[model samples]
Target chain A: MRRSALVVDDSRVVRKAARRMLEGFGFSVREAEDGEQALIACRAEALPNVVLLDWNMPVMDGITFLRAARAEFGADRPPIVLCTTESEFSRIVEALQAGAQEYIMKPFDATILGGKLAQIGLLDAAEVPA
Target chain B: MSGSSPDTFAAIAGLVKARAGIVLTPDKGYMLDTRLAAILRRGNFASLAALAQALRDPRGEPLVRDVVEALTTNESSFFRDGKPFEHVKRILPALHAARPAGARLRIWSAACSTGQEAYSLALLLADQLPALAGRQVDILGTDLSREVVERAREGVFSQFEVQRGLPVQMLVKHFIQEGGKWRIKPALRAMCRFEERNLLGEHRGLGGFDLIFCRNVLIYFDTPTKAKVLAALAAQLAPDGALYLGGAETVLGLTDRLVPLPGERGVYGPAPALARSA
Candidate 1:
């Protein structure tokens, strides 16, 4: 029962950082540079258990991917969490309305990321290796 | 301290246990260097050795209090561990039905660091139990630290704090966003009150509670202290009321006054034998 994640962001640095953290939390992670690539990954491979999405990316942004993913794959699976610099309440409300399961502000460390994963029930089976 | 000896750690541990009743095992000596670094800078003690040496005097109660406060970890989040809250939501209807008409259902959040546990309950009652309106519920959040109590009373949380363990929808519904922060709305704030009260200090003045949450606080105490605190908390619970402990904690050997509430982990009620005797 290996849990997998899809990390979608324009910056390789952020994807690498999130990949390292998610890997530490026992998630097998895959990277997608933008939303179109993420959708291709979703369609070609099995849906990930969770998606760490970045907003404002070039070519299909996160919200577009979210809506499209919901329309095609369904809204509930592969629980999407919006991870970006967007701290605006309106943006958060919009993300949740668009079908994101949770929201994480940028500059989050391992603890914040881990807590959000746990909150969404993604970390239930994957215990962080001591 | 890199230069300090184990005796310095031993001395500080002794002082903390004597003053605050918190057991600091030798393995946790590493925590002193980190947790006390700020106090060392503020007090200009040069090193933990100097602080431990200064604590040798009997009249250093204020400094001892500061050290104790710093050493006590305040790690908490909204709806932490999640299960106890689910159980609370499930049992609330039956508990309310058992009460007399219009009687207030009181809940005590002991050691309510930064007030998340108490405020989480308030949010749950407001969101889940619409039939029981505002005035019918009373949530009391108490802690040993005055600083945290004041912070809890303010009902303000940083973005980082609000993000942890809080559902996105609840955050939108119950909190108002300030610049870079969120404040629990007045409606939710009005349902709860925060106080600086110690579990070991006194309890006669605090009235009985229909549900008590003394989670994660008792783990820092030694066995005898754990038994004592359990007895005292049990004293404040109504006969049929529920008491929730941390998932890692139990009353197995601590006290006979509390027995596990059926079908839930870390939940306890007054021992039927003890309740009947009373």
Candidate 2:
């Protein structure tokens, strides 16, 4: 079974970089520019196994999307990870309270991404091929 | 001098093995290169060869110690493996109940690099074990690296370190932000102490512990060293205590001093035979 991910970030560079990394991890990667598109994509297509969301966006924000998604699809399915440059401790707590499974600071590489995924049970740290 | 020449690698590897009981093979040459680069830069050594030569000198005792410490420093994170922590949480109350009235509980985080494992135990007690209120609980974190022990003593962590394995809610609850870094709250900090102690050396001064966490450390040792360390750990462990090894480590061929605790992963209890004999 192929794992799937929906990356919701306004920056095409970030989405592309994340896609490349996720694809390398054997995940089928999808992209949306903002939270609204990501939510629509979730409803229209099959829900992704995980979501990598950015906080600041044009149409919708990560926290809003997280709340709406949790309410609609249920709280625990398709683990949502907030991948943003928000280093504020309060923001992290807020995202977690709003149902984000994990939080990542931006400027992340494959190692950091893989570690966060492992924390959320998306990947096994020991089994990841070097 | 700094290139990965076989001689330099051999010299450094041999020193580490002799001093720290850590076996380093050719495959870990890259680790030596990466870890030793800082020492070279700090000492202004021209290369790894220069560092290796310096380590050979009788006056290079400090350099040799630093090299060993650098190689032996283990990567750690809070609640590193979720399962072991969960298992500890579930069993702790029962263990507490078994204790005599008002008896203090002590936990050891052996080979505790950067103190995350020790502090994680403190957070567990602070967050979930309200039953332990008014009871004295001590968590001791020991490692071979003086630098890491000092860092652990400070209870300060960079943003990157805190973000690694800690959950957002727990981070908010337990840490205070200080100039873009996080410091473990004073109350929680008081629950644990940090010391520079070698796992391969004497542990007689450290008394019995109700729970011991020596995770991800024995993998670096050879079979003999592992057996010795396990025996030492068993001696310090209380009769009803639990020992947590790394997820990948096992005691099957190592020693008869410990046997796997039933229904738990990566957890062990003193062997029944050893217990009976003792």
Candidate 3:
């Protein structure tokens, strides 16, 4: 099955970039404007297989959404990868502690994004690592 | 090099592979033609045929050196991949555990063009491993291009170059804003040294390293060349050293002399037998 992804970021540009990269890697991608909406999307009948989250967002930030989704989705919660700028590195450790599986900094290209997805095992090991 | 015969081009391509291990296929003839033209003009040769024949002369070292430099890929960037740097940060504690007390730490950025990646490490080590401030840390960047090696040695980057992959804080902290370029602070530049080298040839007795970043250079080599290069790297790596390949490159099919670290993308360690013997 093609894995599904949810990209939650206040910026449409980042969400679109994430969506394009995720979709190219064989994920059915959905976008949410903020953590609050991402939680709503997670509760849908078909949950995403992974989430490409942004650390900062309006209404609620990525860490809050990660905690809420982990509480509500429990075991069904897909791997969350926090995306942020270089300055927000401290929050990367925080996000990982809060159940995020991995992370990628901003200004990423398709190759870097694919490598991160492969590291999380959301993509095939053989195809993606190369 | 312009309007050269196919035989001359083939001979030049074969010579490049033997000299530098950079395989240029017949499809790359136009690229060779374009790059080699400058060498001819610089040498004031009438045609590439004269240059090619001179390459056969016993005193061809300088001419061959120029050819290799022109063929070497000097393209690189700062923090080429964020993941590997993150992986290094995660592994630092482990690396510390593996090393003895107060031992020097060394990192080799193989084929490091213009020293961006090596200096990037210097900056990272300065920030991430503050405790190592007392310990000796050396970052060596090597390339085949004399022009780029000189640039790396100078430790200067233009505004556009510094903006790529370098954060604002790092830009301000580690660099002096010259007229339109950023010069790496002397302290940072002191941690690094640049040399001209051919990966296929001897390293001139360069010693073992704790971490070797030979990223993105293997894609150009043929299978046999890749295997030879990997084996050579394994020999120079400390028993506990890590070898980093490009995201698109791996040791799985190329050679078993190195094995990929489990759960670590683009990181590998010397094979168990190799590590044990070392």
Candidate 4:
């Protein structure tokens, strides 16, 4: 089965890039301008397998969405991977505490996104390209 | 493993300096045993004494190369320090503007261990300078160690090696994980070339470079050796070329051939005569 992902970020460029890379890796990716849309997508009947959550976003930032998701969805929520920059170390720690499965630095490449998927067992190691 | 006497250590250090410019102090003698253990065992030398004696022979040239490779430190990573790379990204547009239309850019990563620094430069160029996508941007990675040169050519790195300095995105896009190691894909590897070279020796054919990264490795040399190496590097740089060094390194009180870029610590451009002329 093809996995699905929700890419939550304020930047249209980041969303487009992430969507392309996810599609390349055989994942159906949905973009959200901010955390509000991410929460809505997650609560939808067909929940994504993963969420690539950017720390900074307009209309409910990523952390708020994470906390909200955990509160509403409980442990049945999809694995959330925090997208952050080196300067956001404290935010990353907080995100992890709030139930993020993994984190990757900003300006991320497909290799890193793929690694995160494999890390959380969303992408099988055997399915990875040689 | 047999104990290496003080004389044995000194002799080994001398041989290493003669082949490669790296200076080994008496205090660093302890490091030889740990670093050169593989060489000693592989070469079937009974002790450091035997290796030293063998180095005295004319046929020991190849062995000397191996010894030099063994002694030199190959510790490196992709964008090891973030500051220099940040500077590279910021200065690149200006550097490009200063040159003639469609001018080719040549970058040198001196003592580039396993080619991480050179590859990092390539990645940055690819990401930032979309204008130069079809231009000739050659990144040369040279080291005194043959093993690392070969390894750099192979573009394979372990998980722990990739974990340092490299962001996860770059790791995934530029490399392919094969079992336990990650090998750089052809696209990234194509932007770089690796070679075994002694910085203290002649390198005329390589010609001048537009940017040079001689970071971190120079601290291994003594003051005099550092000056000589800096002079050589200055000679190899294009008139407007920029040089990046480690945070701990400086050209002040060493040589005036290169001057620091204003407000850009650890980055140097050639002195005014050459830089201003260009």
Q: Candidate 1 or 2, higher DockQ? A: 1
Error of 3 at B197 (Å): 2.1
Q: Listing candidates in order, what is each one's chain A TM-score?
A: 0.94, 0.96, 0.89, 0.91
Q: Which pairs, if any, clash in model 1? A: none
Model 1, B159-257: lDDT tens per residue?
888877787788999999999999999989999999988788779689999999999888899999899899999989998899999978999888889
**Which candidate number would show the highest TM-score if scored against the true structure?**
1
Task: Report the candidate with higher TM-score, 1 versus 2.
Answer: 1
TM-score of 1: 0.91
> Candidate 2's residue-wise lDDT over B1-278, tens digit each?
23679998999999998888899989888988788889989999998888888998999899898899889857988778767888878878888888987898999999888989999899888976677656789999999889889999999998878776676667888999887789999999999999989898989899999999999888999999999999999999988899999989998888888999998879999898755377
Q: How is the predicted docking of candidate 2 categorized under the CAPRI scheme? A: acceptable
lDDT of 4 by residue, B1-278 (tens): 33678889888888877777778888887778888788889889898888789888998788888788878888886766566888888877777777777778899999998888998898888787685546668899999888899999999987656755565556655777776577888977888999988888876689999899999877888888889889889889987788999878998888888999999978998997764356
Candidate 3 wrongly placed segments (more than 4 Å): A1-130, B131-133, B274-278
Residues A19-122, model 1: lDDT tens digits: 99999888999999999999999999999999999998999999999999889888788899999999999999999988999999898777778878887888
The clash count for each model shown is 0, 4, 0, 4
Candidate 3's fnat?
Answer: 0.00
Is model 4 an incorrect, acceptable, medium or high docking prediction? incorrect
Q: Tens digit of lDDT per residue, candidate 3, span B20-52? A: 788887777776778888998898988777778
Name the lDDT value of residue B232 in candidate 2. Answer: 95
Q: Which candidate leads in DockQ?
A: 1
DockQ, per model, reads 0.51, 0.43, 0.05, 0.04
**Which 10 consecutive positions of candidate 4 chain B have the poorest summed lDDT?**
B163-172
